[model samples]
Target: MLTLCLAVSAHAASPDEPLFNLPLEGVHAFYPGDDPAFASVAFDDGDWPTLLVPGKWSESGVSVSTYVGWYRIRFVAPDDLPAGKLALELGLISWGDETYFNGELIGGEGFFSRTSPQLRSYAPSIYRAYPIPVGLLKPGQENVIAVRVGRHFNEGGFVGGPVQITDREPALERAEQNRNQAAAVQWVLFGIDIAALIFIGAAYFGGVRGALFWSFCAMWATHFAFIFTNSQLTYELGLQSLMVSWVGILLLGVSLYLFYDFYTRALGWGRFFPMTVLATLCALIPPIVFVVRWADWPHSLSFALDLAFQATTTSTMLWSFFCAVVAWRGGVRHAWPLAMSGLVLVVAWMAVALFASTDAVLQWGGIGVEVGAKLILLGAGVSLGIHFLDQSKRLARARESVLSAQTEERGRIARDIHDNAGQSLAAINLKLQSLQAKQARGDTVDAGDLEDALSFASVASRDLRDMSHDLAPAMTADEPLEVLLRDHAQRLGEITGTQIDVVSDGPPELGPQAKDHVYRIIQEALRNAVSHGNADRIEIVLSRQGGGLKVSIQDNGSGFDEDAAMQSDGFGLTSIRERTDLVSGRVTIEAKSGEGSVVEVFVPVG
Candidate 1:
């Protein structure tokens, strides 16, 4: 009776035989007879392989193998079933496979395989999954599953489970729902990452280190996007799947190098370039191998190269962790977030590496290490966001400090003028008034001494006025360039007793900042012409030049050497240069030992 039962089971549902009678619309379970060889074989939930019914494969003492041939299964649908479309769900396949149902071809292609170390190595590729649609399976009739799987040197065959059936509507609905949920989660994480990346990029670019830091950040964001898309959450964007995977590895490598440069510069640690280059070369491994595949290289070589690439990536990540630690030790004000983010990313990557290297972890618990990787990426994004906010606040404080320093400097200068020059001028003015009163009363004072005192008072008064002008120029107000320049020239002429000629034309109005710079430049130029050039006559000319205004102050005096004047120990000419620079203006000074000096300044009015 046992022999008869065994024979009945072997040929019970051969390729041409009908399936056991069962409900057409619900789930059913099929279990192969207890073969000791099947005990060690298990399905990869990470990449669930499909089963073939009514078939068995020979196995090595260790595991099942499907290298020799195809496997087939037969089932019969209920004849009373509705006429709607049907589906044969093949959970997953290993390496590659082709499926046929009812003597008609069904969809088949390469699915993500966790069996290969390459697929399992990365955090994004830990999940192995594929779906084949068996459309219109002729409900309530005999159906056959013929799967041709090719495996080499290892236990393979259909190691997963038998096929199942369901109505097309509910099956499609569930599949779509799963896809949507995955996409939503993936995109939410991606959006947060992108926002953090943008903030970091903006802050890095705005700071003193300039575009290099931002470039590193931008590349990092791109790499993260590629990784996110390749993850199990939304790995089905079609052609982009393989491309993004490869590109992500490449960009991650490149970004590591860039980050090395930026980190060193921003943090003042300059010894990390060598390690960065080594890491970059490691990142290049995958793309190189991919390109050389057309050469028909040995599979072992390709595998070795892939391992090397991963090792390099791992090393680079480790180096980043080291750099972060060093930065933290160096008292880098913003190091905490970056260091923590790097540490988390490294930990996440290491988790994936551990799982890929060992099969026992996957065998014991279905949950692979990729979940940790996703969480790590999320954490890194948060860290970056916090870092950017902190940096922005620091910049604001620095700017405030600079402005306060400028205000204090200006106040000190004002105080010095008041205490020394201002007080001396007041006393001189009082003595001059008393002397003039005595002279009018016929006191018979020496006219020469009286003249000398009057001259001293006048000189002191002019010095005080010049000091006031230097401390706070009148041009800071909403005054026109024409008016300011005219007033400045008159004051200079009166003080220096020189022939100062004033001329003006076209566009009396000027931007306030522009006018202020121009007035300061003119003031400096006139002072130089009077004190240094010793010119008896000075001509101040203001005229229109294109969309700007030009003011020329020429003195008929003993001009000094132009080059010597520039290199000399004097701040007057330097101050003129600085004033012109502030307004984006240009200044030209022409002078020689015997020739008169000519100083011209041009300022954009708009």
Candidate 2:
């Protein structure tokens, strides 16, 4: 018969109490690879090696981090211990664990049978307390507590944080408290990452939709995803273990790909062979490690391959650090923040890696390390925000400078044309008229010919004067746009031999810029009707609606397919559209074959 004893930490059972409380002293183990059949309570494991309860196999000199193991402990309940629904607290199993009372399954963290399968694993380190029914405990009789452990990920086996059987309420409260505390770290990092994501969205909406900003944002996002796969966190949140584990694995590969891509973008391609070659080697490391791991080679090959993978992984990581440093020194403004944060996280991870054999260190410090990994993303956020803001400011300043220079140049050109070109044309016209009069003095030319010559000169002079005036249209301060429109419409009607009806209603309270765009829009529409549609009559309507101005020009003549006209290089309509867009207005043109056209524009007025 196997006997085990466990002392109670909460409250030791008194002599008068019923022997319902079982204090586990130690367990008799039939370790994995020993006997798979010894899991039953009826199996004799008295001769097996003894292991302490409330501790992992690593405490018993188990060198291998991952394996399957079974632990069985038997204890006698106090005679006076109450027989009711007791609780069995088995805290924080790393991967998977199942509890059995007297060889019947009570519950499990992660369990899979041949017929049933679990899709994903959950949050890594959640506290668990299984309820034990009164029928399962025997007062003054030997009772067994057996646990099967499956170690698949990260510093494997049952974490052995806490073990006890106590009142149901306390057990539940303890479990809730553990979960809340464990979740705190995840929540902190989650907040930072989510906020950063929102900031990226804000920038996009604010007219900063550059693909480069979002490209690195994706990498930063994926970098923080690795923290979610911790088994306790998964359990706390009731996530699927298999799916979480798979995502965790896939994130590693995606991380590698993004790592390669980040450097590729930073260094650019084919520019420097040494840089590209190094990055290429870094990119190749993941696939090579995958091949080595998947091939399942011989022991020596596996050992050597594992070593090679470790070396390559470490080197690539170091190379990433080096690149960040190089970028920082090369005057990449955002590089230092990223490098500093990344280096801190790297050191934390390295410390964890160095002591992976020490289970206690991993259990105590691993969560902090995971949090640190996510915290580094804040550096990315700050860097991106500063960079985008600075870029926007620079662009704005550059635009203002360009606009100022363009205004100055336009003023100079207008003056030069009015002075030199207009004067020159006027002088030529007068000289031509004088020559025509002199040529006709002695009947050297026919009277009709002289008249035609003078007429051509007069037309040339008039056209030159119109061209000079058309170079730029200026409006005097406090002049309402309605008056300008009336003058322009009257002139156009006389020129086209078309009757243009100009109607204005309500006040014209538009900004100078908006009024300018509105006037140009109407002018273009009227010209297009006369020139393109060969319209004989144009109706121009201007009205103020709420805080905006609406203008419509309708003509009756040979109409056209509006789509074809808009798509084609029709200068009048194209200029109209451009002017409307300049004022952030909407313009619609409706026309069909053999039907007249209507062009309407809306410009907001201040």
**Candidate maximizing lDDT:** 2
Q: Give per-residue CA lDDT, model 2, range 96-155, as digits (tens).
A: 667788877777765443112221344235566788876777778988777776543234
Ten-residue stretch with the least lDDT total in model 1: 120-129
- List CA RMSD, all candidates: 17.7, 18.5
Q: Which whole-number lDDT from 0 to 100 does residue 321 have in model 1?
A: 67
Q: Which pairs clash (backbone N, Cα, C closer than 3 Å) in model 1?
A: 19-76, 46-128, 47-128, 51-161, 77-140, 77-141, 78-140, 79-140, 535-557
Residue 201 displacement in candidate 2 (angstroms):
1.2
TM-score of each: 0.45, 0.55
Q: Candidate 1, 425: how far from true, in Å?
A: 23
